[model samples]
Target: MTIKIAQISCGTEYSGIQSEIENAAATVGGKMVYPDVSYEEITRAVDDFGFDPVSPQLKLMIARAKALADGHYDADAVFIASCFRCAEGALVRNEVRRYLQEHARLPVVTYSFTERLKAAQLLTRMEALVTIVAKKELLARERQVGLTAGIDSGSSTTKAMILRDNEIIGKSWTPTGEVIGSAQEVLDEALEEAGVKFNDLEGIGVTGYGRFLIGRKLDANLIQEELTTNSKGAVWLADRQRGEATIIDIGGMDNKAITVRDGIPDNFTMGGICAGASGRFLEMVSKRLRVEITELGALADKGDWSKVNMNSYCSVFGIQDLVTSLAAGHTIEDVAAAACHSVAEQVYEQQLQEIDVRRPIIQVGGTSLISGLVTAVGEMVGSEPIVPENSQYIGAAGGALLSSGFLEGQ
Candidate 1:
């Protein structure tokens, strides 16, 4: 039972806990190999692996890969450490889990230390992670069953996901026009891609702004709260550890600040649908600036935001501010960056004022795809936000998880 751990950390702020880990490792009959890895080594690996260098947070991930690959820290398991509120820590931890599982063929565990946690709780989580890793062989084997479908019908788009034995087999989405038509279309597309029929689905779940339409039209077996669906989907996809996380879901016309505790909604706040903080606001500004929404993030990144400002109260005024800033000799990039800041401000000041946003913040929805907005939100929150892959389709993913659970129960 003496487990040897090759440990990597995101920072030295929690170095005080090193002794605690040592004590706990000894108690559990394990030893840790925490080599003092350099940033230069991490940067080299990042370049070698072709990871995006612009984001400083990626250093954590690159460093992890480098540590695992290097022959110095040879061990039976890997231990990753980061603060609970550290966005880089959360993202890197999740990525490393997959990497170690596939490439290294080793068990990995992450310890998310928080100042708010009592010593007992912190030790408990660490012990639990170690136990989970130790029991990977037993937990890895899961029962496979029939296919399940989850459909998300939002105000601006519809998405569908097909899950077979808890693995995603197919996913598809389309712009929303008529609710039922869009829902049916995406569902059909996903099913076709998965080579399955509607009748073959053991259970179906639906969620989103227009989820009511789908529930009424399709008679979905499960109709969940949009916030619940968002949190469930985001938590599932991110593979976050136990405890709570903040979710910023920016949809077409609405935005939600959801607090998910143990993969369930603890609390939430919804921003006004007509506010300038939503994706529609971004689209409006992008159109006025004669730039594609996809290009807005890059443009904003290039701009000097030191002198830029924009109205955050209303979309109309926000667009007007963007136009005025451009006419006053400010570059379009500057205006675009300011627009991104304005959206973040609107969410932070107007919507998130009521909710206690705990990190690691998982940002989802189409607007979150904008790199600039993500950066702005991170700056405003004083913490980096974790943007997962295929975030916009999290609602559909959440529904799929719910439907899959339902099928398993049957």
Candidate 2:
């Protein structure tokens, strides 16, 4: 039976749950709906779940969890995915089971956000990790796929990638802490890297933290939601027919999860105005370790991680967890893999089963570029995480493809 599911997470600051749920629903031939809420709001909402004049924070958290299942996500079932259930989870669990006993209407199946995360971390240690589809697959997806340039100018860097024929022709990443100057320079650099002059390209789409401010003057102003661009960019060369899959784009600022099912956008969600479970958090941690972001991926390839002791909800605490692990003689690879697991756990806890969705989830964005992330997420979806060749180009490619109205044509 095709289930209509509402997938929710308690306090995920990232984007994995929603889109992954959408993908999960699609894979299982289910229908999914997304009710958007920021992670902070979710965490706070749990506070009120036990609104029967509950006492103490822990009891209140439990009451709130129960109340939430009773009130907000009144679907057939509630998917309780939280890294740490806290007192809130216990209460939520009690309410769900109680409701089931009294009403006996629908069943509530709980998936541990932490377990999914650990599985992802474990997969990072595999010696024969699945290699991403080769470049030829990307190029073969579409003939004469329009070439476009996506430039993400950030506080510390300007990144531009060229997408053509479903393949990334070239990319340019240069430090431009100042968004203004690098905006102009990176365009030229990206065009050069693609080996194509500006006039030859069909479109140029811009995104990211500095996308709007920078891309306007270039007369190349195709502004898109960072999440959609990120997710679609990641799916540019996937095997889903008619683009039937959800895209999970977890980035520096927040997570943006999009549900593109039945070859149409069913729903999309984003974290609002918070740096919780963000790419910036990872970037900060990487900086603290004096490591490059690219290097972090290769580091996760080593099979050494066994324990990750993350106790904090915030990234700062997460970094501290990393520090503690290092002090305990954890290898760099283990630490990085654990970091990815922590992130996945946070995301899963916040967004899973609030809406029931499908599988074959396509995980994308800078974090998705991490080997550990893809592996961890794959286990979360009960399937291999789909990362396209030129995984980095998914956003750019999606923007370009969407700009051409490719879906409309198909």
Candidate 3:
């Protein structure tokens, strides 16, 4: 069944990414539908929203959102978008998203697009919305009941995990190269460690950048986007699955901040404004400090970030700041702490502002293993983040947990 996704947007046609948006939805077994609203309805919606925007396009956007909220449209999910350049559009997009969440009670995602926006960029968001609609029960499941294996084929690393009756028995993490081969290697390692044959697995799930390709190759039972999966895994790992919590995943190529309720993501924002806010920047900083990435965390814990100035928002400039700091006689530990702090601050400015952050903030992903980065995030959020056991395997664990929901039918 193709999930009907409502497209409530301001300028996709003018920006020349409307087709890209449609194609993304189609690729993920979703059909984009425009909610119909008359001009009178648009006027009424603007009046009811109590903030009339100067742009007529934003007025129409509000009308469509109102129509959805009032049950005048039938949609499984909602996708609200506007051009990045439009401040008014951004305001309307965020308001519409909240409106739908409150009144429509539907799964929703909002994006600020550019003319260069490609379907690849929107695929995960569209896929996640569809997953929330089609696999609601699967995502809501709290525990893994049977033998299941999960593979996370990430941009920089691949990980695999095996779960049996709510316990993770084995897991593997390796640097990613050839996507399929990386996934297979970790799967083999995990299965070997678990002392289980591949055929013994009741269900297999895959996620991350290479999910579609690897899922098709492996015939995965649950091929899902990481937003929902990561939230589920984070909550489950942190033992916060029963309450409202915020999840932060600072990944290799990008970052994700999700607001989840009862283990399911109700709101999420992914992608960074630049690479400087991601794990890749931290990796470069580690190299500049003549330390391994894993060792950078310990080094950062030993120094004060205020001792150096490394506030560049671009990774290249960030590195330049690092070199300048070291040349000025700053210690490597201080430089490392500054780099971590810079990344955390950028994440807060670019992504965290997109949602209402709930507490018992859980930080997951490979970066979470870096105590320095975790500390910086804690400092930025004014709360110490809960880093669960085996946090690095969150994507794989999420896959395994969600896939187990398919076992009953199989």
Candidate 4:
């Protein structure tokens, strides 16, 4: 179904990009719907919708007031058209935005007809806004069918997962950049892969370092702590509803240790002092060694990590140690394994201080994809750690599950 955008303006003059905006919306399978309501009609709508006029001077305010008053708009998004040097727009845009944000909750895009307004730029902006609105509308439809999405907007990567009936049908990850854009990218990719529409999702949950930003931008229904979500996710993925387990989640910027007891997150610790145990450290080492991150784990599995002892506690010093080892005739595999061991060792010495090693240990997060790192952590914790599928997406999956009420009251 095509998304419909409500075009609203403050002044009597047209913005002169009506055709361009309409074409751009059409390009993205959307329609531009202009409500031809007069001032009297809007006043009557305010009376009907029961919203008192905030200011009679602000024409845009009246239009939004009327829309809210009537409680009816055929559009999924709202576009504010204004001309340059319009004092009315400047005076009322903020309050108008607040009203729309509070009441309508629909995506709002503004177009200012400045003297330098290029056609290409206008079209691009229109297309982008239309695309965002389309996704929102599609997700609204998906909500009717028991679907939800979770986004883990981590410092390193943005991950998205689509859940239906408490099961993840689609998941995707991309490097985190321009938070809002990446959030959309990951969601779009995941939804497309699942062959689902945006409206299919009943809700959206966000977690991770960038969770707050993405949550606000996406209007997420659930914004959870990474530690809590990861703990819930690890237990869920491991299928361990009862009993204690220690979870090691090493991400790009930080390494987290979550202790789950009887399916509840009891205690958690995050490492911030050193980067040697984090994914960023591994990425740097991989680049220095000219080794692909994906290939490092397999190679490390075969090498003798004990031979290349990495004693550096900091990431900077760790790199120096690795380079020195290479200069001293150590092989790449040995260095890679040593790097993985260094991360595990840091977790044990720093991040895992309060956690019990006697219980089952679950290694998760993007770093868990490295088998050698998983092996190293298992060895340190004295038990073979369980590495669940889509370990990188565990937080997002947990958020999705929480939104679906699958992890509620647990």
Candidate 5:
């Protein structure tokens, strides 16, 4: 039942992303193919997305994704793994993003490099179920539906969830500074809320930037792809009210564009290497403006007509633009809206590049509920993006669902 999966890793020559991916793939007993350079790949991908797929780096990445997809040719199915920069965690990241979006092979493209690293690790550990969370649900009819939990140790947040009967019964989130201690604290809190003992759980799953550190310490299973986790969570929340979703997840250091169809995750995209126009960048700018982190959305709504000149979306250099705009007398609201524009643009482009933007959309993550962002993204995306309740919990919820019997114990 091993499906063929293709992984296209870009800027692999410079960053450790390729090495990490390779190591993960090897561990999972999965095969991979990468182009010597990005150019040979542009021609192979179909022009289906109205994209030329001609950017050398993109072609290189596509070549990798194609390779993974090709591996599935003889298998029952195929999954595509498109990866961006490796974790050199430095300035050269611009080169990677520029190379990726030069001609924009996929209209709405997202690399989510950091998120993918965790995904790669999970793929290596449980490659079979990495992209197949939905697949496992078919087993729900046979296996006993047991209590399962997902301990998510995010860079700035610690979260725990309990999924019983495909319902998220109890969930908790706290800022994370110390990994091991924070994980234990949150887990105990979540279990207490659920009124369940640790022994009641069948398996534990973990994800997020801090996953490797805390996940390894635990003996349970793990799933890769924040994309998968988030998408699944979005579906769960949206389904609670029979609402549809086109999720925009803007975290402290990153951003994502996820399209969910009928309460089921269909496709998604991610931002550049670091968090410019993403969460981290937005937070930094918001802090400099002395604005409360949660109030950014409302501030954007009140922004004046002054268009900002800060074009650099890189979080590192974005400060200069913010300052320059302010020196010119732009109000804080005006400046923040411009930042909102930058991020909203990224999300809009990602979803449109893949599918027609006809479906109802939902925005998740920290920025999902932003006041001004919704209208801005709606106007740009051509449809209002709804922010579902508990949007932040989508990914963890998905992980919890996997442990819940709705999938395997029906």
Candidate 6:
């Protein structure tokens, strides 16, 4: 089925990224349609929304959202977007998102775009939105019922997990090299550890940056983007699938903040302004400090962040600050602590603002294994985050869990 995703935005034509957005949706079996509204309806919608914007384009955007909410148009999902350069456009964009989420109850993804936006940049978000609308029942399944294997081919690392009847029996994590090679290596290792041959697996799922390439190579049953998979894995791991929760995944190249209800994502945001706020920054800190990345977490736990002034938003400048702190005779522990704190603070400032953060914030992804980073996130969020067992394998676990729904006779 071709899911119809409604496009609500302003300046896409002027910005020249409209086709890119449509291409992204179409790449995942979705058709982007605009909600038709008359000028009289636009005027009425502006009054009903109670926020009048000066621009006529903004007025039309409001009317389109209203039309969708009022069932004047048929749509399986909503994509709200606006040029990042416009402050007023952003306000209208967010308000429209919240309004439709409350009234229309459809899957929505919002984007702040630049003229440089490309179809590749929007593919993951579009794919996830399509998956939510098309595979609603698959996402709702709570448990793994058969032997399944999952591979997460991430930017920095590749991980694989094998699950049997709701239990993770084996897994492997390794630095990512050639996408397919890394995925194959981990799958072999995980199968070895699980003492199961490939023929025994009932289903196989794949996710992360290299999902499409590796998924095709492996003939995956479920080739999904990480946003939906991660949330599914997170709630399942944290045992919070039955209620409202927030999921934070501070990944290698980017970050994701998701607000989910009953294990399914209603709204989510991904990407960061810089690598300084991501796990890649911490890896540089570890290299500079001459300690293993795993050891940096323990060292950071013993130090004080206040002792060092490493407050650069760019990863390159952040590393320069790290070197400066070290040259200034600051302890390595303090520098590690400062690095962790900086990333946590940036995540809060950049991505957390995009969603209504519900309680029991579950932090997942490889970064969740860093005790210092996890602690810093807890301090920033005003509550300790729940990092579940096998948290580092969230993407893999999510794939395995979701793929189980495709098992024979399931």
Instruction: State the lDDT of candidate 3 residue by residue for 217-287, as single tens digits.
Output: 99899988899988888888898889889999999998999988888887788985698999999999988
Backbone clashes in model 6, listed as residue pairs: none
Worst 10 residues of 3 by lDDT: 264-273
Error of 5 at 40 (Å): 18
The residue ranges of model 3 lying beyond 4 angstroms of the native Cα positions read none
Cα lDDT, model 1, residue 22: 64
Task: Tell me the tens digit of each residue's lDDT in model 2 across 1-410.
Answer: 44544443444334244445445544434444444444565456545443332323333334334444455544433343444455554445445444432442333334334323432221111100110111113222332256767776543456677777656687766665678677667778878877899888677777666766766766663655354455445555564535457666666656655555433333344442334466677676677668898777667666344566754368778888889888988778887777766666556555433323456577766677778766655656567777766555455555555444332244
lDDT-best of 3 and 5: 3
253-312 per-residue lDDT for model 1 (tens digits): 778787666665534556553568888888888899888999998888788666677875
In model 5, which range of ten residues has the least summed lDDT?
88-97
lDDT, model 1, position 173:
93
TM-score of 4: 0.63
Model 2 stretches astray by more than 4 angstroms: 1-147, 153-158, 163-168, 239-243, 272-276, 301-306, 353-355, 406-410
**Candidate 5 error regions (>4 Å):** 6-24, 33-130, 133-146, 166-168, 240-245, 260-266, 349-358, 406-410
Span of ten consecutive residues with least summed lDDT in model 4: 136-145
Who is ahead in lDDT, 1 or 2?
Answer: 1
Model 6, TM vs. native: 0.97
- Could you give candidate 4's per-residue lDDT for residues 1-410 as a string of tens digits? 87877766554234455566666667656687775567787676546544444545455455654574356545666666556566556435444544564566555555445544444444433443454454332222211125878899898899999987757788899999988899899999999998998876777878876777888987777776676667667777777657778788998987777666655543455655467778998898889999888888988898788999797588889999999999999999999999989888888976675344437788889989989889888888778888988888988877776665522333
Q: After superposition, how far is residue 386 of candidate 6 from its true place, in Å?
A: 0.8
Q: Ten residues in a row with the worst lDDT in model 1?
A: 135-144
In order, how many clashes per candidate? 0, 32, 0, 13, 23, 0
For each candidate, what TM-score against the reference?
0.64, 0.59, 0.96, 0.63, 0.69, 0.97
Q: What lDDT does model 6 reach?
A: 0.92
- By lDDT, is 1 or 6 better? 6
lDDT of each residue in 124-211, candidate 6, tens digit only:
9999899999999999989998999989999889999999999989999999999999999999999999999998999999999999
Query: How good is model 2 by TM-score?
Result: 0.59
